[model samples]
Target chain A: MNDAFSQLHPAASFAFFVAVITLTMLYMHPVLLIISLAAAAGYVCILKGARHFGKTLIYLVPFLIFMSVLNALFNHAGVTPLFYLSNGNAVTKEALTFGFYASVMLSAVILWFECFNVVMTSDKLLCLFGRLSPSVSLLLSMALRFVPKFGRKIRSIDAARAQIGQGSAQGGFIRRVKNSMKVLSVTLTWALESSLTAANSMKSRGYGAARRTSFSLYRFTVRDAVTMVLCAFAVGVTAACVVSGGIYARYYPSVIISGFGGIPALGMAAFALLCFLPQLFDAKEALVWRRLRSAI
Target chain B: MPQTVKKSRVTVTLTVIVLSAAAIAVETWLWSSRKYYLTSVIIILLAMLPFFARFEGRRPQVREIVLLAVMTAFAVAGRVAFYWAPQFKPVCAIVILTAAAFNAEAGFITGAAAGLISNMFFGQGPWTPWQMFGFGLVGFFAGVLFGGREVKTVPMLVYGFFSVLIIYGVLLDTGSLFMYSQEVSLKALLAMYASGFTFNLIHASGTVVFLLLLQKPVLSKLRRIKIKYGMLQ
Candidate 1:
């Protein structure tokens, strides 16, 4: 939790997301995603220690299996089924393959997001946007902040409701439906009150009455410039690939075009993006130290 | 002095001309490869300029920006997650609600921007313009009917439901005709809608229900925003 809390620096998270996405998009091989999945697991263990990692696997494993099964059942492609059904509508190998691929993709994305969720705290995002669009930025940050806070409030509300025998989940369908109206009304009231408070706070600060300026914690350095240049190249290359029909072949070899393909370009972009990772990490460390130093 | 004035005038004229050219080029490409409704983007882009020029406030309203960003995020996320997740039907409903609670123009701009933003995730090809038009149309009119909060339900429900179906139909017809199938006919278009009739019905009905449910809360809240932030003149 300390590690996760420390990681909640939006700039660092942004850099991490940019790097991971660029890399994963460019090198979308099953092998790479698997490696990423492993790497993510390793990082989690390192940060939260072995106990949390173990906790994650127990829940994640069942989810992965469920996702795999659901995708296979629904996809309905390819004729090579592993087992023959009584109706001869057996689950195809392709569907199963797609399912696994989909699962892997989903897991990889989720893993990165877990890291992101840990690092990019709401305060950081709010601070980042406080310049140009104060009201909106405040709303955004507040919304993000409110979600977790509201969630806690709702849990408390639920506990109170449970004591009163007013909790919907414990009741029958019709009763639940009747209870849901109360929940919805309560939640809506909460949202409205929150928005109003946030708006009032803005008004008190003279928000949106005059020109507002935003300040960003992130200072774009030389590394950032180099990284951006590389990303631009990657974007160009991807657009070229799309235009050339290399990425969208309906049938094998029919709509084939030129270039090292989608995955490779994504790699170069990732490489470009990742080249700035050291600076990102350093910046994140410095910010934390600054905060600590100030506190001290 | 006359030359600088001439230059500024020239710059304005040039900006207009360049934008017009871009619109023409985009429309031509879209028409050749996409659909008629797609060309309406050119029209919307033209519409957007006047607002920017007119609303030359030093800073934009925070509430408006926040609303736009949320809608935009939903719009982008919706399309990005389309094949894998539920359509951001809720986002459009929010758009509908926002427009109804505020101004028609607000809805149009928000809807259009949200649609455009959403297409970025899908890697915009041909269908973007029509989707924008669909969302924009819903939003622009939502304000006309519900934007003011006169407190009518049945008319809004009927209006919202048909609006959704029309938007979906427009999208399907444009997309199918221009890109997917060459022999795209109205019958084929209708058939597609018919096949997904239940889904469309549910989607439209659900939106109407959702908006109706949120109408009171959303309107009251937006009124607070306006009063607090001077969002409306």
Candidate 2:
């Protein structure tokens, strides 16, 4: 997980994900969808390795197909009917194409999100939010910390219950439910009580004092600046193209894809570059590592 | 400090209204652009902002912040614990109880935060905002309805059932339509709802069951903490 892109400032990586995911959701053009899906797949494969990528695709592809078929079944619009369902609704080619396009967009968005989760860890999120509101960020950080703690407590409580011959795993459904409830109740009381103590400790330490500064490990470097600039440029180019109808598409009476060569191609290329920037960074890092090894 | 809080509240309200109006305008203008999910995500984010803004303006105490964090974490843990049981998460029930014990604002924050943080483990996607919105609304309405009251088990279970079924279930199901549809129509929306009905029933039933089991002891504990600490009055 030593990807160069993720090593950038949290804001830089977060902005990139926002741009790519927004574009993926907004664009219905077939070429753009394919480009996004390919870039997302490349990023995921590089980020999580090939085997993980294959596993995700195995689950995702079927979902994509199912969604597309479901869309076609539900929606009976447009000209150029491909076939008719038993309910006498015409299955239009336009609807089917649109369905597939939507599915690709969804899959691309999902894959990009996978990359996002890997890159944007909890501390990164806290850092980003800390800049906005320290209170909210503190809450988020505490919640993040407490999730694991609470989980461990729940397990311990369950174990204690089992030790006392009151295991939730034993007995009928009602009894099991009651036993688990007892476990949850004890855990809840402990959480609330301990959290109050934690609050007191913070108060003793002057938590709400004026200008209470929080520490963050992330710092914006030269590399982050360059990555942000490139992402902004790509986003600007594609947004202009989309706004000006250069990458226009329609799927109603018929499937129409206009602005083929000039602006549309440029937009798609920009989008591809934007979407694949992480992979590019990873590749460059790998190349540098290899060169260093050779010199050594 | 009170004046500053009032001023900030006004500013937050204005900002939220203006942002919501702009979002709606863009959604309408881009009606044929097939960016339903994008606009919806923007709207959802905008909707959550005011709650955070208010919380920030209040200069809340450490106890309040810690309580919110603990509640959010517990809800997330509940979801994780029930991961193997599809649609059987105690998250909704926990959220409802949180709202009932605290204020609507607290409930909203806990539910929304839990939705987000839990997804950090479950994997996030286009559906994250919708889930956040759904859970937030469930918590909010529960707080509005039963906050600071001794909620009986039967009523709590009933509310839990319907809130999950309607608020969370409908919001998520509708989100799927926006995500997966090129052109939304009544027929298509109905189909989507119908397809999701079984899953929604399971989720709602799970919520009811959790609420039924958890109502008395959880509420009593929350009441004890609230009185003992004088929290979030």
Candidate 3:
């Protein structure tokens, strides 16, 4: 109903991402991986809708299976051997489990990044780094904007070339490739000349003559502050647990996972809470909106 | 102005040297300790920080920043254009051309930016840092070898071949090794390299093809723009 998490302070949103992604990569416990994957998928579905989730799955499922099988084929480092490949490497349970873990971790990271790309827009990145390093931030934001602009320009160039009977998709594979290179050369020239004008315009506006001040729309609200503190506390708890071997796991030589209890269980709970914080906020906002509408 | 420019150059050179040494030391420690995930993250951040600091201190002109952004965009667009072919992208060629035309720092920024922004389409994972490092090094070497000079076709082609190998064969393979094993072994390393040889070959050939076709025109056009705008001087 309400997607208010996206409106949080950029620092809050960015810190959430940095914390979750780092933990997802570092904490290899299967339970943690599963929890992260579920939360990441849930967040992505909420942000981009169900159709995008379906598309992600279409690409991700086969990739996960492929990685698992590849590892099973090549890595033979476990106590329990399932089978022997033709290349003489024994497929072990540990290898298979490790592959599953790796794929889950990889996909979870990727999904979180998808959410990041949607929520942490280029302007946020600029705002985050603009004060500390204006030039680098400018380059980052410009690069982000230019990517889509260049994509459109390439399409227009291709279309125009097609009208002249010299398009990239004209003939055999080689011919098409050569034609594409031609299109690329034309685009390169155009991009260079246009960038010069853009630069000159910035210079005329007194760019680099003094310290640049940027206008920001983001404000750290009370809600954002609460979210930031909650996130930091959760992340700190999880990191301490991980560092103290509370959620320790081993795959090679044997799949021995530490039993969940005490600090380890607490760590897992904190991590799950941290991962689901945005979703929980969104759901709460939706419920409040629905109640308000009913009262109205 | 000239004296300050010279002084900034010296500072940049010193920073790069010190950073490289620190990177090697950290890498040795990482390999010895096998803290692959955490340590590699630190190392990657370390690898990228000095370039940003160098740029901040030198304060590149607006035109140079714009040019770097455009070049990075072009490199990304090139990758998108050839998406039909796996591992066959013109990014390496464009990076080399940028390096040869501009200085190493600009080249590194372009290459790193291209690797990063392109991942927005290709998907990000642990492979990202290695990819960034590979492209950045390719650009760095090209700049060191032929910055502001006329790049001969034969030598440029050779460099293109080797750069792609380093990217796919060495850097990406190392990333794969880390992903697969907690501890590194020579056998695993060799096996990974052997398995990726064909993909690396295809990537290298693509670089050679693009470099042969795009080098002269791209380099000449960039040089003209640089001179016309009084950029990166």
Candidate 4:
């Protein structure tokens, strides 16, 4: 985020990052999941500033921990046993370890996407997929931006209804539920009326015309190319690692892995750098935002 | 003018019928050749019917219209997603729950469509039509909630449980039917899948859990989804 390398051309970088994380999931470490979780935390901290990291940490840490534990319990996988089940299934040390590692991979994938979400705004996204099912993509992307607003509008409508004594507050739980249904139905009708108005407006404005184009401004540069190449190189390395089993070095209770972490770790660090490289060149926007905030 | 709206709707219907026919043709070709493709083309046409059709008589509310489409899509999708899982599975409990709130038609459409469309993620095969029928039945029963007002839950849950039970059970038997290379009796297949009753229990329990957790959220959101999407008549 604020790593000064984050504000760069984001399209290829984002897809590149997602690709690497997804591919790495094919072969990764329990340590890597922890690292990913940590990186997620770190990435958030970098974005919103260290002050907000505490709140983010509070919310995500517990969930990640819970997921890790649940995966370990349910997914009795791996080659070496750490413990024996009462029904005689062994929790292979490898399985438990791999589960934990996979969790890290999952965390990385998630955090990486979150980073994309923050950096790649809707305007950027529209530009990214210019060729594919344009309508569907536009609609889905709009939904993403609009869904929260949609939820908010409903809440506000309900609150307004309550103010007008239209709420389902009386009678038994059953009756009250019935009333809520009626209220929701009425509210939905009102909402639809408004939507129709909007749609008609769109029709009048010639929204269905073939000439209309969704446009955005985010140009690609030479650095973007190098960054892409570097990222792709990392992706290739990640794939090569997974296929060759270089990504996950294991120590079964009986089997130990040593002297193997350095290369993959270096590869990941290189990727993180490429993914964040955009920020390094774009000082103006961040600086302006900082200035605006200071003035506020 | 309202007349133009009617005309437009009529035109859309004729177009949809043709489009649907075309899609079915494509599907039939695939079915004949590979016996499997995703259920997108058919499920989509089914989902869009209310949107395109102009009911001059009486029309369902926008919520009903959207929910109908969603319920169709959800039931089909959920069933398809869990296809390879243990037999006698519960999916599309949402449809059951919602239909119980509303009526049998809603439930049936949701379950049927959900079963059919969710296959789009993977491939649709010989089992699509059977799953479609199975889920559609679940929704149909759910939609028949007795004496419930705008909001119905108890009936929804009951309907969801039983409808899902039948849907999943029949699906298992029917699945066995499809898995066969040639002709086989339903009774024989049912006997074979009769052993999967435990798995059915597992599936039913899972669906019930999902229904309980998701019903409130989905119901609350359904109205809003209708409004936002301009699914009103």
Candidate that scores best on DockQ = 2
- List the per-model TM-score of the A chain: 0.56, 0.92, 0.83, 0.67
Which prediction has more favorable lDDT, 1 or 2?
2
The list of candidate 4 runs beyond 4 A from truth reads A1-10, A29-38, A55-92, A141-164, A169-175, A215-217, A221-223, A241-296, B1-233
Query: For model 2, how many clashes?
Result: 0
What is the C-alpha lDDT profile of model 2 across A1-296, one tens digit per residue? 46788888999999999888887877778888898999999888878998999999789999999988877887787888888989899988987888888888888988998899999987888888887998888888888888888888888889878987787897898889778888888888999999999899989997887777878888888889989899999999998898888888898878998868888889889998998898888889899999999999
What digit string (tens of lDDT, one per residue) describes model 2 on residues B1-233? 57877887888888888998898798778645746777778878988888888888778899998988988888888898888999999899889998998879888988988888898889877788899889999999999999987677777788898999999998999898887776778877888899999999999999988887777777888889889988887
**Over 4 Å off, model 2:** A171-173, A290-296, B1-11, B30-32
Model 4: per-residue Cα lDDT over A41-100, one tens digit each:
566566666777676557656755765565455545566666777888776665455445
lDDT of 1 by residue, A197-223 (tens): 665577679875666666555565555
Q: Order the candidates by DockQ, highest first — what do you get? A: 2, 3, 1, 4
DockQ of 1: 0.10
* Fnat across every predicted model, in order: 0.06, 0.93, 0.72, 0.00
lDDT of each: 0.56, 0.86, 0.84, 0.53
Please give, for every candidate in the order listed, the TM-score of chain B alone compared with the true chain B. 0.66, 0.93, 0.86, 0.57
Worst 10 residues of 2 chain A by lDDT: A206-215
- Number of clashes in model 3? 0
Lowest summed lDDT window (length 10), candidate 3 chain B? B30-39
Candidate 3 TM-score on chain B = 0.86
**Candidate 3, residues B1-233: lDDT per residue as tens digits?**
68877887677667766776676676566332344655565666676777778787778888888899999888887898789999898899999999999878888888888888787777666677778878888898888888888779999899899878975468888787776455568887898899898999999999999899898789889988888877776
Among the numbered candidates, top TM-score falls to 2
